[model samples]
Target: MNTINVVIIDDEFIVSETLKSYIEEYTPNLNILSVINKPNDAKEIISKLKPDLIFLDIQMPILNGFELLKSFEEINFDIIFTTAYNNYAIEAFKVNAFDYLLKPINVNELQNTIHRYYLKKKNNPLFQYGQVKSLLEKINTPNKTERITVPEIGGLTILQTSEIICLKSDYGYTDIYCKNGSKITSSKALKHFCSLLKNHPDFYEIGKSGIINLNYISKYYNEGTIILENNIKVSVPRRSRKAFLETLQIQ
Candidate 1:
């Protein structure tokens, strides 16, 4: 088995050391190339060493994980985010198909993640740099409305958030309907998109498995159903009915 070169970038010394020890103990095939505690120095070290994988912390003083990633013009290496962020932020990671470990990392989870990484490397040698780039763009641009990157088999499809008509959850995947009558199926879960579009004024979660663009809503029935553009109809659950009506300012 070939050894996988790894780098740990965390501002906290103890956290970084704990992760280092965990990798050394649990994953013998993984080689710890470097343990960087300073976010400022990470760029230079990572550029020089060019490890196969990086375990990056999201919260740091000088530069956070997203900011550090933005500094890199091209992300050739794979990233495994290590964060103590809340559920909303974790959803972003899931939507982007990025692997992440929560703080005080579980040994079993870490091992499993590494195993998955090995399998991914074996099956698909090419890393999806587009995902990382899209994530960075979302993080860097707070004012602008973010575009959604739909991950297809061959590559990624960037869609303006406004162009989305509605999304329906099919098992674990999401089917996105667009205004131009194009539908894109994404491997990400519905809850991920829910979190991703939570801040958007137009996008609203109507039912357990459906999200609708309020701007495209053409009709709403008192019986708890809404008709959006393209003749797409979605049911609004009782629990969400009040809030949905309130959003529409329907007295």
Candidate 2:
């Protein structure tokens, strides 16, 4: 197996060190070229070493991962972004077909991500710098509509917030129901989507495990039951029933 040179750029010392240890112990095919804590020095080091893959952190002082990439005229390396769950960043990565690992990194996910990268490299020699460029543009542009990236088999599915009828928590995963009569299972937890759509006007949390889109509501009963599009029913807990009814102006 050919060794893939790698560089890790994260501001947190512990995070970078933990990742380094995981890679060293688990993935023998990947060589750790450098673990850089300073985002400012990353450009010079990356330019000098020219590693095959980069493990980049999204939020950093002085220069962020996106800004660091923007400094490059032509990107020749693949990137796997590391970030604490940020809806916008995750959406951008998914939309652009880039790989990302959520922080407090899971060892199994790390190994799987690296394995997938190796497979992709073996099958397709072409690098996707255009996707990176597009991601940067998306970040810079103002979006009027809200959207979320649903992780599916093989790749990601981008759904407009309006298209979603409701979200149901199924243990560790979230089951998303769409207006188009399709269901998507996402690895993200219910709280993740709740946090993502918190500020949006149309989405309301029905209980601990469900969120329903206000626009999709077809009927609401005084007994704290909501009937949505496609005849889907969601129950509102007694504690939140008053607020839920007020939101619908049914009182």
Candidate 3:
């Protein structure tokens, strides 16, 4: 059996140590190169020692494991990510990660994950640049651009959900009002934007004509009316009013 060079990166020392011990006691032909707690510290380790595998914990202080991956130019190693139950992060992992082990790592599950690692090691085609790009886009999407890509006559316009104060219907098309004083007319109807933003936590409908991004909103008036940042006002009808307020409170 070929020795699999591995490094473990986790903020919790005990957690990393426990995993190290488990791998040593239960898994064979795996050489532990370095056990690191900090992402910055892991940089030197990674550059100096090109390990075959990395047992990465997604959430770490100063820098989470995912952030560390961005620093590396060439990711030629397989990764088994460890993360807590984060809705977005979990969704991102669905795109990548050989296998993700949830917190309070189960020895049996760990063993199973290691077994899968061996199977993948035979053809470890993980973490290509495009794959990595898509993966991070999924993870960082909600809090980042979180934009709706609208195809236009000239090219395209990306309306960042965070910057959108509200949306209004213009016949069949939708007019997106931004905090930056730019107005956009998307070919899609207001209902389409509503559906796209339905799962998105930042937007809520006001009246029949409009949807407003929650982060930009300051307060809500009755019947879908809302006072947004910079005192820009917008409103929706009574039908969506109740649902919008409830969604606001939940958000």
Candidate with top TM-score is 2
**lDDT (0 to 1) per candidate:** 0.80, 0.82, 0.72
Give every collision pair in model 1: none
**Predicted structure 1: clash tally:** 0
lDDT of 1 by residue, 1-251 (tens): 78989999986666788799999999999999999988899999999999989999875654668879888988989999987655556777777777888776789999988888788778776654668987775555342234654544444466778799999998998999999999999776787677667766778887778999888989999889899999998999888898899989842
Q: Which predicted model would earn the best lDDT?
A: 2
* Residue ranges of candidate 3 with Cα displaced over 4 Å: 124-130, 141-251
Candidate 3 minimal-lDDT segment of 10 residues: 141-150
Order by TM-score, highest first? 2, 1, 3
Q: Tens-digit lDDT track for model 2 on 1-251?
A: 89999999987676788899999999999999999998989999999999999999865555667879999998988899987644776888788778888876789999999888878778876645667788889876222226555654444566878899999999988999999999999876787677557756788888888999999999988888889999999988889998887888852
| Candidate 1 residue spans exceeding 4 A from truth | 139-251
Q: List the pairs of residues colliding in candidate 3.
A: 206-236, 207-236, 207-237
**TM-score of model 1 (CA atoms):** 0.55
